[model samples]
Target: MRTDRELTPAELDAFGAELDALRERTLADLGAADARYIRRVRAAVRLCCTAGRVLLMFGWFPPTWLLGTLLLGLGKILENMELGHNVMHGQYDWMNDPELNGQRYEWDIVGPADFWRHTHNHLHHTYTNVIGRDDDIGYGLLRLFPEQRWKPFYRRQVLWATLQALLFQYAVAVQHVKLDKYFKGRISKDEVRPLQRQMNGKIVRQWAKDYLFFPLLALLIGANALAVLTGNLVANLLRNLWTFAVIFCGHFTEKAAVFPAEVLENESRGHWYLRQLRGSSNLEGGPLFHILTGNLSHQIEHHLYPDIPARRYAEMAREVRQIAARYGQEYNTGRMSRQIATVFRRIWVYRKPQAV
Candidate 1:
């Protein structure tokens, strides 16, 4: 086992090879019964997402409309947190060949693949908890840490982000695309092919139907159009807030690491995974919290093997802790309320120097 804090070139190659071997071994060891459970869960999540989308479209008017929208929004939130996050990791067996299983474009279930790729694959995975590089800490306009120094205007950025989260649909629409382009360089035509192909006409039609056609239909139904609009807006706000709060509690809390670029470069994947584990925490409330938050409480396991299904993470976490202990690394876990309070305190107290 390599004990050095930083990997030499040869060690890096060996590490890569080891990871590949481990991945194959792990996949091979996955029990047949577990595989069946994975399939069943995937199918169930797919059904929930499909039904939620359908209901959201139709649920705009009358007494039934209000109830339907509320239920559908809750379902959407559940699917996004639980199913969508795991599915994006390619945890589902059908991911590689969606067409083979008649799986529609995944964006239909979540929001967009680009959003996942940028926020998760690129920013979160690559940077982990490095203050500036990881977009998860981008609290919109506010510099959540001292290492993320910005202009004075950033003080009010949190309010701006809250307002934007509530009202700015197009802004949210283009966020991942724009960020990827700005940070990583221009998005190649080929890179967006999945999104373009998936979205094609269906997504545009749905957007038009939902925001435009649906509202007009509600007006015609003698439903107070303003009330319907307000309800939709409120529902969306609540969903976004819930998502943001959970994510923030995990990575922006007091225990979370805020590494400099130099420290980040010195870190190994194992070390980085440990840092994320120590910095982020998991709540151990009940199955409901696990279901609603996508088993994010097992964040250490998720960081180590993102491809693992979230439903199975609790079991995997036990194994991960043993591994961490053998490696002499710390693993963090805690209650939800404590994590939330820690996040607020950290964000409020964090400061950035004018220069590194």
Candidate 2:
């Protein structure tokens, strides 16, 4: 068992080989079971959305509207997290179904799938928690890690963080546009122009689908358009809040590590695996919770083998924990509430300590 923080050259090569073998074995195990799981999830999402919208059309009744909105929210959350995130990760790419195609599927979110693929799959996955390299650390909004340095702006983080949670999807949508990069002259206006256009197109379609077209259709059916619209808004808010909570717990828990930029310089693959493991924390949850969070509750496993189908993460998690134990590494994880409390605690640490 290796106890070193940094891997020796031989150890690095050997560790990479071990991980590669694990990945291949896992891939070989993928089959109809994984394919059927995602297909059912996709079907459930569609059914829920269809039923929810139909119920909301009877919006004069409070119970019907509330239940409808809840269903709608659940469907949207599943579409983005379980279906879209996994699909776009190429988790079901082997199925070769065009609609389930990861490379081409567009999610029902404000963020363009293309941008998310680049920012999350390429940037976040590649860099993990390496500060300045992975934008996901604080997401350019709050100061989650002490090493991020203090500024007067962070004093308002309570407000910033709250608003961020409420408007989480939109915040994530704009993240890949590199507004800060352009301002700092790292990127130019021309580079962001095409991205801006793509965002605009997606935003228009999302707005039309959710707010305008649906509400207008409800009006045509003699339903209260206003109530239907309100229900939609409520559902979206709920989805946003839930997503923010789950994602925060996965990455910002107290035990999660944030790497320094210098430490990532010429980082070896073996060292990279260790960095990813330390940098990510997992949420302990049941099967339903895992499905809801797109199996990202097993964040440690996801970071280690992002290309693997997320549904496999739960089972893979057991083996991963064993591997970490053998290698004398901590596999950070805890109950969802505990992780979320730690996330909030991390946010408040800079200003004043909060008991987790």
Candidate 3:
């Protein structure tokens, strides 16, 4: 079987058509019972994480503020890595209840889902690595190495990519919000609903509770204000760094392909999916890594079927790879350390080409 690059346009189209048919047939064969089980497990994991946060915030078993804050950060990291991503993809909708389905977007527990949907589903899924179009490129920060032509700084150092990843959430959030405003001609009423809804008494109450009430209570109860503040900040920084690093390695690593805008624009769904597989790799082994990182190890499968539960992703990956092999596409995968190293190298040496 010839590789993706070896296939001509006509050959690529033919392969895509066959894969589309196969995907439909496979989805039709999925058992409702299995889907339900997957959903139940997803819900259970989410609930456990939520409970852990509540315990960290309110339980009296441990009086250490630092430990409590660290636990809270860990809880958030676990939820985001596992339940949050799957829920956004609607993988937990086996209940068939509209309310339950919509609960995935309840931002109070999981952060804003709309932002994720816009970036992940609307843009990244469609464009993959299409330079200016794919939001995953630099997560809206520095230019992806392949997209950077004249940035001398990026060409000099890839370790800076790690620094970019450290601040990815803020960069992504700001960029998406601004870009949506710019392209859509104005902010839609729907887009601001989340912020507006939070402007009510709930915001006031949360502000008082988290900032005024909690901190004062901690100080009044004989805890050192400086220690508690420093500890909480450290925990948050560590959590965010870990989360961002994992995400960067998933897409920005060496095995990941960076496509030119022209090529990406002309690609079909099959081509885009194939590109995602080639660009992203599964990190092998480490049961703890799989659990904590949400089995994002089956990244290609997740990209192919974002709505499939993560727990089932590993099993589904084998079948998906078999299909890819039949169609002559190579499935990319590697160890976590190798992937991390690749990310650093790619970031260090990445630069856009000069315009003609």
Off by over 4 Å in 1: 1-26, 29-66, 93-104, 108-111, 164-174, 178-206, 213-231, 264-267, 325-328, 351-356
TM-score for all models, in order of appearance: 0.71, 0.94, 0.74
Model 2 lDDT per residue over 1-356, tens place: 12335556787667667777788899999998988899899999999889899999997598999999999999999998999998998888888899988889999989999999999989999989988899998888778887776667777788888998898888888899989788889999999999999998998998898899989999898888988898888888998999999888877898888888887778888888888888888988789999999888989888899889898888888888877776667888889988899888878876442322
lDDT of 1 by residue, 276-323 (tens): 555556666787777777777667666666775666677666766665
Per-structure clash totals for the candidates: 3, 0, 10
Q: What is the C-alpha lDDT profile of model 3 across 1-356, one tens digit per residue?
A: 11455566677677667656655665665677656754554565556534433444443445544456666556555656665666666765654645336344443222246666677767887677667677677754445555445555544344545565565444444444554454556777777655545443344553454345555665777655445444444544565687676777667766566777787655676576667667666777666677567777777777777766666667667777887787666777778788778776665455434421
lDDT of 1 at 81: 67
Identify the runs in model 3 with alpha carbons over 4 angstroms from their true place. 1-5, 8-14, 25-70, 98-104, 107-111, 152-163, 179-213, 216-231, 264-267, 351-356
lDDT of prediction 1: 0.58
State each model's CA lDDT, in order.
0.58, 0.86, 0.60
lDDT of 2: 0.86
Evaluate residue 279 in candidate 2 and report its C-alpha lDDT on the 0 to 100 scale: 87
Scored against the true structure, residue 39 in model 3 reaches a CA lDDT of 57
In Å, residue 126's CA in model 1 sits off its true spot by 2.1
